[model samples]
Target: MAKELLKGNEAIAEAAIRSGLEAYFGYPITPQTELLEWLSRRMPELGRTFLQAESELAAINMVYGAACTGARVMTSSSSPGISLMMEGISYIAGTEIPVVLVDVMRGGPGLGNIAPAQGDYNQIVHGGGHGDFHPIVLAPASVQESIDLTVEAFDLADKYRAIVVVLIDGSIGQMMEPAELPPMQPIQKRNQEWAVTGAKDRERRILSSIYIDPEDEEVINFRLLERWNEIEANELRYKEYFMEDAELVVIGFGTAGRVALSAVRAARSEGIPVGLLRPITVSPFPYARIKEQTELACGMLVVEMNSGQMLQDVLAAVGGKIPVEFYGRMGGVVPLPDEILAEIRRLCYEPVAPSANPRISWMNRMNITKN
Candidate 1:
């Protein structure tokens, strides 16, 4: 297939259609609004379902209803919009319903800018809703990867019978790039015995998140934990660059990861030994790979588009064995490649005052976040 230029949001919508997306329920939000708009026209033409709900909450609940009927359903929104859907997401997770959610994140604690930011890391990856559940979060660094991962998100959501989140920053969502769309996948029939489509000649199916008995709730939690463990073991995914014999490793994800990789190459060209590790699956988090790769390096640098959200995860993975520094630009500002390269060089050569704790000292000098 010939590659066509497309905006990140358009690419994602096209990919979802090809992947047999049976239904989409979403509210218009900046950076992600294009995704909904594109699908609105295309989905109906293809005889699929698309609805613009009155609110993000309503949209997510619609997705919940569609998913219960064994439909491949999805929803898209930005930061505050996604926040509105948390209650519904928790219900979807608890019910073990298969669905996909696209979070084209923008800045903010509340109604932040419509610019690119990875500030939603904690909210999406750490279970924003009230429960002990984790969604399979996929962070795509480029437009092409966004399309490919959208398809994978649907497949994994169905395979695990759980919610999957395609977490992309605004930079990736609104930016245009050349992409080859995936082949059309055969539409999967939704006439499953588990579906609550109408109890005709079969046992009535009940899909409920509520567990009346405390023990039943505990049992549900246990089963979810087991499934999460299996996903962690089998679904951990990441990418490595120039790690064969490196003195420093840079860690990032989403758009920040793409920028960090460019910086790594620029530093390498200048004879500085630096590498990069990007977590493709943010929830499972590639902690084992991070530890293994950074163990031999002098230190690690975590570049992000937020105030060190993923930095905490990097710190946990390294266990303070080696110095881990952080640099980020919050509230929609993105850090430049030169800035990341400078930090990488400073961590490698600069000598600074020592602190009571090595981790503190490591972050004190390099951890800079722009407001």
Candidate 2:
């Protein structure tokens, strides 16, 4: 197989087709619009299903309908569209239906403009759909990452009998890079021993997250939290770069993660002991892994496109063992590597007052409409 230059959105669309998704139900949303456009044509040509739903509500319901039939399904939307689909996602989570939701996140709150912002971090990772559950979320920072993780998202969704989200943003979805196509093989539909598609000749499976009784709901919550704990123990994944002998560590994900990577490389050239903790799975956040690394650093710096969403998680994970600082450029404006590298230098080598705040805020931030 040969590799080709593809935008992150295009890579995801191509990977989905190659993964043999039975259908895609989505409405056009910026950043991810090109992906829907690409798949709408190719899926029909390949004798598959692609429906441009009238609205986010309709599209998510379409996903609900399709997943009920034991189909591999997906949908793409930005922040607000994803907000509208929350009800459906909660229903799907409650029923334990298998699904994959792609959130090419843009600026959030209301109709935040079509620039990349990860403000949806807490919402997506912390049960945005209203339930005591954690969806398997794969956060990819590059075009190749988008392709690889899209296919893995479906697999994980099926494996867990739950929703899996590939969380990205405008730059990753729109930026171009080279990626190789994998051979197509039909993903085995999850065995229906537990799912509630229909009972052909046996006791019917019931997929419902609702329990009327408070005790039963409590039990369900306990079971769900236990399951999440299991996931955290076994599935929390992250990538570490240049951390063996580092004085400061930089943490980020998605597009911000990529930018931080560049800063890490630059600091390395200048002989600064800088490392990176780029998380691949944000839902089962790599708290333990981060804690392990922070033990060796002077301080940890969190860089994101939001007003320090992930930074909170870092603080909780740090347990005040070391000072944790945040540097961000929110709204549509993403921080450049050179800008981040400057912050890295300040944190790496600086004299400060005992009460001085180390946070860095770039001047070119955009106004974010919070929802």
Candidate 3:
């Protein structure tokens, strides 16, 4: 009802609770530990389940088991911790159960730091585990968005019988902002015909990811692909700013997108025709929208907190119709508005050729020597 100054991690935890989350299983991990900590106290008080598992591996499997019973279960972790849960995640995907995962990303390729970074974009959006399935990934730029997306993740997961990931960086997880949380939803109990509740007095129902026959596994793969097609068609989402009659466009997501917006505004004041396109849904990326922008914009600048992970997707969407440039800060380093503003200026005055590799150009600009 009223807005409160809330930390991102705690807000997301509370939002999940209000959305009728039935169980939470997670281990303590930096940047996201507050989420697990908040739930540890709140869940039990509400007579719901909260557990600090032995490890990230154990935590994900616990979520897997709980979700099998048609419960609204979730688990949260940082980058390295999420890596540990990949195999279990693949299992859940193969079994076709709805589960919510919150990944508050930190600097990493391997346990880098507890600072903010968007390095896990490829891992989460592209599917890290061994699978032919696509997980619905939503990226939020602010605490309010984090809270809202947390609630949406559950609904999307259940609707598609798929995994839905609410992805944000450590900065968003740790920052405080004034935001309104949704009212607590009464938990609705429904008999899930597909769940593995005791098959007492009825025909036994079995749910398993294992398919011994190649033909059967192929069938499963087709089913997953068909569902993914539906997601791509119905779920593409993004935000645009100053796009009307702009010739140069900038694209980013999450914190990087937020930072880019400021840069775009500064450039606009300087008489540059620059706009911003921020994708809220990273998976099932807004390819069509980006393609449409190619006709209106002369060029684009892709910005991120990593080494241009989303840049690849932008390239695919643009399809060589226009030149695309990239600028990024890696290893937990967040780029400033000024930095992106400079990139926007360059994109306007000295555009690169469509055939040029943006990442290498960026590396050269940053003075990073090729090995």
Each prediction's Cα lDDT score? Answer: 0.89, 0.84, 0.94
Best by lDDT: 3
Task: Give the poorly placed runs of model 3, Cα more than 4 Å off.
Answer: 368-371
Clashing pairs in 1: none
Deviation in angstroms for 118 in model 1? 0.4
TM-score per model over all chains: 0.95, 0.93, 0.98
TM-score of 2: 0.93
In candidate 2, what are the lDDT values of residues 60-104, reduced to their tens digit? 999987887788889888888999999999888877778899999
Tens-place lDDT per residue, model 1, 1-371, is 98999899989999999999989999999989999999999999988899999999999999999999998889999999999999999999989889999999998979988999999999999966999999999999999999999999998998888889999989899999999999998788857666788888888889999999999999999999999999999999998899888889999999999999889999999999888988999998988988886658878888899878888898788887777777787899988899899888887797433222434553565544311
Pairs of residues clashing in candidate 2: 94-209, 109-370, 109-371
Q: Assess candidate 3 and give its TM-score to the true structure.
A: 0.98
- For residues 182-236, what per-residue lDDT tens digits would candidate 3 score against the true structure? 9999887757788888989999888889999999999999999999999999988
